[model samples]
Target: MDKKSELRRDLVSGDWIVISESRSKRKHQFAKKEKRIIVPRSSCPFEDPQRSGNKLPILIYPEIGKWRVQVLENKYPAFKDVKGCAYIFKKGPYSVAEAVGHHDLVLTRDHNKRFDQLPLAEAELVFRAFKDRYEMHLNDPCVSYVSIFHNWGPKAGASIYHPHYQMIAIPVVPPDVEHSLDGSVRFFEKNKKCVHCVMIKEEIKEKNRIVFQNKNAVAFAPFVSKEPFELRIFPKKHIPYFEETSEAVLKDVIKALYFSLKKIAKNMKDPDLNFFIHTAPIKNKKKYHHYHWHIEVIPKTNIDAGFELSTGIEINTVDPDEAAKILKKN
Candidate 1:
């Protein structure tokens, strides 16, 4: 079949979404649950990364046998090194470019243990690796933005059961990030304050939407949550770059992240979740001072229907205040 994928724009939000009718299946097809098959340790490729044909790790912690956390080149990368920076060209009326960038995996030692299951010290190491690699990728001239994200369970798009995170450095800033940056800039122009910082202050005062907090970090269900059980973790202080955050603050942020995930597992019954960092673009440092770096954790609670597909708006079944109350109890 010919590829029938096209990008459609939402006039209200100015966001673009792919509409691929060729990829769609019957309505009942999505409801059928496949049997959860666990791949054995013997067949798991991450067991011995080097032995399994992966290149030597770019960064490894502990500097000893049985690595705790390691960063390696992705065997099957969505983006790869190219001769020059990405160049845009017109094909018919649409613009296209090469997928030139860096893609790597952050692997942990344990196959069964997820991020929330790891000890606090071990969990902190993961974020350390993320920051280190993020800074490294930012140095490249081709990279405009670096995305650091984790996917848990099959529903959240984790193909391999082995616990791992991914970093993708792309030439173009993603549309979602662009929209968020635009909103922050607009808010700051009018109010002369960071949008996220304002939200943090209100959330602190309200106290109902807070899930967990410490001296440096706070996690809460967002006031304008797009999905059920959506949670965001932000640094109390204004920070534009995730790579430039202080070690002390990052540790506290990681603690809040761990606590939030633990609560979700207990209260939501181990729902598949995706967590990712959203910060300023790598290219511009000063322009996005109004932006605040943070992490968004979205559980795979509901799927989009026809109405949601046609329109850009989401229909969240749970309220952020009630979601926070449930999470706080856990």
Candidate 2:
């Protein structure tokens, strides 16, 4: 009989993902170098966002000449900022609420340079802009959570070739995030320790799955990785809030992410990827002290087919250990 596939449950989210090494005949088969779409700068909206009909930037770095990063209202916002808080009411048997929130874009100056290719200083500045905008939304009466994410390449949902990130402040905690928060709190209550910090300690000790690590942060292919080459970055210390992260710790986390992305591009054949920050909710901050904030980087290496769609379980073809080995190579 052939060896059976493993069902690995995520430590933090409690979601189960199938790890079937037999799905791919060879290691190289897992590398799907997604084609890069090059939109001419002349036609790119981000080149001159104001001229391209975007709202004036809400915030800009350097306050003076030659802005390096700018945050502007998303031209096509999924959530509109209405006059009042989104209130839940009954629509017969269903509950309904106004979709009231804010959506913004953080754009970098160079069209050609993606996050991995950005200079360390410029990349850090990008995150600083995110922090500034996140802080701005903290006072909003309608906002409950803020999402910060970057989609690179078309597969990763980057419609425009110009590199940009998105921040959406919404009225309620999203279901996926809620699951993670619930799971982490449950673990903390039971064990009296942060779940992510425990996982980080194990990964650091094991070293098999670690992709990159600096003085204050570590990036690794998660043991229960839901997708091929899936990686997570965490501050070595237990930090529950992204906006409150100290400058020294944030720089190390940024360095870990910067190095990991470069390795993914070099070793994994430049596949399109999405990276997002996961932190405690903006409201009731004290209730989530047990949570440990982190970044999840998922390369577009696998698509959810029928099994995944029907079962809500992702089938990851590549083993995370092997993925880490490949990415760890110089």
Candidate 3:
């Protein structure tokens, strides 16, 4: 860190991360390894989900022989699907509650092809499965939020090399999401507009950090990026909830995502990455109408050490403008 280091705050979440020019690495240094680990298809659980000791799928497409995509209950779930609401109880000085919710895996038929590699129709089907499962959780009293995310490659926390996405219904809103929701509420109260919509407008005007854009959605590297190659995708219109989004708008968003990931793979040497959706909590839909829903893509280019772990502020090693410039190239 040096004088060139700048502490930039995120407009939507109000979190600060440092862009330290002194700590920046060369562009080539961030490229992924020449060979990514590949798990054998014969041993993949998703190849024959039922034979691998997984329960019956919660939902399946086509509902017949030779499934294209299916959603199954995670064999080992982080949250347990149990009856009754999660109630907090004190254990001496600490308070805890039951982790009652659903964790399911959405798997495509192809074991080798990742989500980004899917055909547009297939990719859209994955999202449709996400929407169906998400809506199923809406009636559960124990569920307060549903997180939809994908972890690509080993470094991005994909223990299984086969391509799959996860949908997790949780008893409470996560702290990071809580911070974002609270910040959105605060901004709307003060400015009388959606914070994310404002950022999207500014990004549209600036154009320097834009990676890809279509008529209804745009993808860009955030000015306050927390890591190298961090990108955010937002619908052009102000949409408060992911589940409520129309098919026409959602298709454009998926298209933008497809192009963005393709650019990253081509330009950044197929780096491992994690992407997750941020939306208003399922518990209070009306309360967060002022909030805008979007997706965040963070490539695993850097790791946290003592400083980042202690202070909770990330040291981004690449300038977002530079990142966008590289990704924007054909």
Per-residue CA lDDT of model 2 for 266-328, tens digit only, reads: 887788899999999998878899999999999987778999999989988888898899999
Encode model 3's per-residue lDDT on 199-260: one tens digit a residue: 99999999999999999999999889988999999999999999999999999999999889
What global local distance difference test value does model 3 have? Answer: 0.90
The segments of candidate 1 whose C-alpha lies over 4 angstroms from its true place after superposition are 1-37
lDDT tens digits by residue: candidate 1, 1-330: 563445544321345554443544532232224444577889999999999999999999878877899999999999987788998999999999999998999999988787999988889989989988888877788999998999987989999989899999999999989988998887788888887898899999999999999999999997667676789999999999888899999999999999999988777766778999999999876888888999999988678998678877565555577678877874
Clashes of 1: 0
lDDT of each: 0.84, 0.91, 0.90
Report the number of the highest-lDDT candidate.
2
RMSD of 2: 1.5
How many pairs in model 3 have backbone atoms within 3 A of each other, for residues 3 or more apart or on separate chains, i.e. clashes? Answer: 0
